[model samples]
Target chain A: MASDDSVSLRVTPLFSLCQELGARFTPFAGYRMALSFPAGTLREHQHTREAASLFDVSHMGQIVVSGPDRVALLESLTPASIRALPPGRLRYSMFTTPTGGVLDDLMIACRGDDLMVVVNAARREADLAHLREAARGHAADVALLEDQALLALQGPAAAAVLSALAAGVGDLPFLGMGPFALDGVLCWVSRSGYTGEDGFEISVKATHVEPLARRLLADPRVAPAGLAARDTLRLEAGLCLNGADLTPSITPVEAGLGWVVGRERRLDGQFPGSDVLFQQLAEGPAWCRVGLRLAGRAVARPGAPVLDPQGAEVGVVTSGGFSPTLNQPIAMARVPAALASPGQPLAVRVRDHQLDALVTALPFVPARTVGRACSGPSEPRNKP
Target chain B: MSKVYYTEDHEWIRVEDGKEGTVGITDFAQAQMGDVVFVELPPVGTVLTQGEQAAVVESVKAASELYAPVSGTVVAVNPDLPDAPGTVNEDPQGEGWFFRLALTQPNELADLMDQDAYEVFVAEAGESAG
Candidate 1:
């Protein structure tokens, strides 16, 4: 574990705010994180639906690409078209290895000058090296924002919550970013989140995190949430975890993220792994990622083998759990192309028992448009 | 006439008709583990020694091992827990009871703590240090 190392994972300025709000703490990616609170995961999940919740996402890696040619330099690496991204707009992009597998999926926001990229906590070091090597001597300077803390306030009342705390915050729409003072603390505010809800991600200096978090959480609708609820929330929303759902072994197409690949970049063939991606794009991969809905009460956990009617192993589950929203076991698996069809009958081998499961369309929970142009949580229908 | 005893592991046992006892977790255990969602009880005929896990209590966070206060053979289980797990949190000592066991040896009761001692122990144990 990273805990055994001398250097500890950095805590966000909102750590004290989380403690004051009654968050249950646990270790995640070397950082101590809240698991849930007195209300438990169920209520916390509901709170996001009925109101709003705050999450301390300081563990995520934030880096700034500055100097001339930064956009074009970053554009050469990710599949998402960074050069065309308007100032103050954010886009989801993935970094690919030489073999065309995903190194990591990240959110890149283009400011007037510098390019701000937010990545998964677990992949921070590797992502930094990948970007550094690509940007080396390319008129770009990579600066990691280690002194800043990242916080996410998400759910139905997110805009209202920010509107109550800061001026001009309510004006920022989805994927929009602007500078503002939150509770007298200067910070960068973005109307974006991972939970498929209307929300804002705030970047503040380390010292001001706690006070600002408390001020925002003072709203009656806001509650302190943890990683447990966050995981379930993102899973229910059909968002993929970097290491679990994506890896260097899987390409963007195989991972169902073909849309993020910019068309111009494909024709130009500048980025690494472009050849493999082009090939896969032309000829569909043999195996593709698909959503799996179990038939019985049993849950098909990660690493559980997927079998056909003849009981021959065909695929493996990468992420699975009992979704609080759907009220049944749901999973994402990499199965044979033939068995990846919606409504196809398959079985997940749990222990010595074979639980009946079915192949369902990805994003089992259909994205709904709640108020404020935010995509609401996906709800996968239960079979058992 | 019978007596109920408690263990530091959060289990409670009440002596029944000679050599038989009813076992379940205390109210403190349920409270510490927010909402009780599932319980895995031992089979009726299964025999268990003292300190062995008698049942499994799972909440939203994770699953916990429920140890036995006294050695015994399983006799009955609460069928109501599978569908209505909140019963255990509402009444860990009554309708939410886990199982009945036929005590293998009556002398094992000496190792358990009485209600009064268990109360003091629970007070100092804090929340979920286990």
Candidate 2:
């Protein structure tokens, strides 16, 4: 179900600019998003790892919960320590079902009195409905920020590029958020990105997004990237894609996202599906997510079978691609926890070929974020 | 002198002796499929039928099959493609050729579109697909 080719398509604010820059359009979550620019996906991916890339992530759903009870309402929705987060801080979280399955993964940023939550494009409608239904008699004001556009400027050189345009941007911590003036344009910027790079995700008004995009593209270190590069970069970072690696039937514990369930939430158990999740935490989920380094040059597309050493079908590949950073094929799979140890031998069935693969550590390409403790490339750990 | 013919699938054959031709995907095809990371060309002496999948082209986004434009036997593949598959995206119609084929049914060429006809086909296809 990774196909985002919806029947009808709407264009984003930067759609025309993307076309002018020689973009290949792919229908994603009902929007005609660029799959890649003239530089292509591979080059754009490499460029982001080295310099910086400007991605028009306008299609992502931005919802802001503002009011006296905004923080309380958000705390009741997810398992992250939202109540404990100070202003201008961000936390990665997910909505879990009563069965402990993940409904959707979202980014929650705490503004002074408002909580800004960014959900995946495909799950936006459902997420909005769920939030609204939960806020019937509550004091929280649930509204989608459709009037705003989200742009991600990511890579190792991302800070240098943004610091050149905006003041005080380089001072923000890894998950810090604040408002900054860029050439007279006000923008809500966050020192974070999905690509595991030292970058910023800027939320700006729809009418003002194009000029800001142009100004950023004018920088020699910044180039246009697209959804394809976005997907590959997240894969390299070992991030899960909702509807693929995560779904309503896949719990966060099983998805190897136990990190999102903070210690306070684990004891209080106020979130949905706390019972099933607590059980899984004490025991273990039958199937768990694992990082893999494929043997050959071909990519192991999602839905490809994962075979045990004895050639028995044991798992399924959730996400995969040729890692431009690693210069080899890598994939993530859901397999038995017993088979998920580091250096465990396995094989992936891609078309008519069965390539030998090993259970490798995630974040195949180490993250280079600023002011953050990034994991080493070969750090062998059983934890997520 | 060799002459070129085109297929609706955006494949091209440069026929020199009318019985054998060098085959490669058209520039439009390469552009349609982003940057090619791998091209799975058939081995020499492999038999192919017209409209059959003769090779696989894997881009960063997805993989697609390259259909044979006419029936032929694989003579040789571009030796440089395995390591430098980006050539298919850079010079798709020239040195980036996929393979050479000895035509089994040469008359199948007549059913394909000529250069002018293909230009028109690409125009209409691009408009409709876009």
Top DockQ: which candidate number? Answer: 2
- Distance (Å) between predicted and true CA of A333, model 2? 1.1
Interface RMSD of each: 6.8, 5.1
DockQ metric for all predictions? 0.25, 0.46
Instruction: For candidate 2, write residues A232-309 as lDDT tens digits.
Output: 999998888998899888888888777677678888888788888888877878878888999867889999999999
Candidates in order have lDDT scores of 0.78, 0.86
Ten residues in sequence with the least summed lDDT for candidate 2 chain A: A373-382
Off by over 4 Å in 2: A1-7, A373-384
lDDT (Cα) of model 1: 0.78
The candidate that achieves the highest TM-score relative to the unseen native structure: 2
Number of the top-ranking candidate, with lDDT as the measure = 2
- Separate clash counts for every candidate: 2, 0
| Candidate 2 displacement at residue A370 in angstroms | 1.5
Supply the TM-score for candidate 1: 0.86
